[model samples]
Target: MLPLTLRFSLLALSCMLPLAALAETPLSTERVTELETLLYQDCGSCHGMTLRGGLGPALPESRMNAYSRDGLAALILDGVKGTAMPGWDGLLTEQEARWIADHLQNDNPLDE
Candidate 1:
């Protein structure tokens, strides 16, 4: 039989596994790359290739400060009413929207 300390260690690892999995980003690496592509190629068309603004408003951190994380995610999914921004809910999942919002909010680099 395993030693008491080893058993305890195994139990601890088992308990943490589910939480670690749960905390993981819902999008897989491949999916994230694809979404980034869409975010840059399609979304950038209006928001600007550099996200500095063109047809749409600038998405830099200063301009994005007005939105909360959840609010940004909702906007990404539902879009602004009576505006050029089209809802991506038809194309992307809620998790994907939230991920994109976080990526933007944190000023993380997106593929150009």
Candidate 2:
């Protein structure tokens, strides 16, 4: 039988493997659009039609996209400190936030 320490180590390593795989996978554009539409209809009620900022801060010009996917995921999970941006961890998943980050990084269609 394996020693207790070795057994625990193997268990931990095995648990982390799936998390690492999940971290590497990115959301698809179609999922991104679906999330965007949800954001527009729900969060957009205050954030603006284009997320150009309204009652809430503008997201398009924000440097949010420059941050790592994990960073954006945290923001979505843990709302902006003292801001109107509510924590969306309950409403959205990390994958969805990553999708939002990807979409926000692109040039606005109106700017073209």
By lDDT, who's the top model here? Answer: 1
Candidate 2, residue 20: lDDT: 90
The true-versus-predicted C-alpha distance at residue 53 of model 1, in Å, is 0.8
Tens digits of per-residue lDDT for model 2, 3-24: 9999999999999999998675
Backbone clashes under 3 angstroms, per model: 0, 1
Candidate 1 is scored at a TM of 0.72
lDDT of 1 by residue, 1-112 (tens): 9999999999999999999977845678899999888887888899887787789876886556568988998999999889999999999888898888888878545322
What is the TM-score (0 to 1) of candidate 2? 0.62
> What's the true lDDT of residue 47 in model 1?
87
Candidate 2: clashing pairs of residues: 53-58
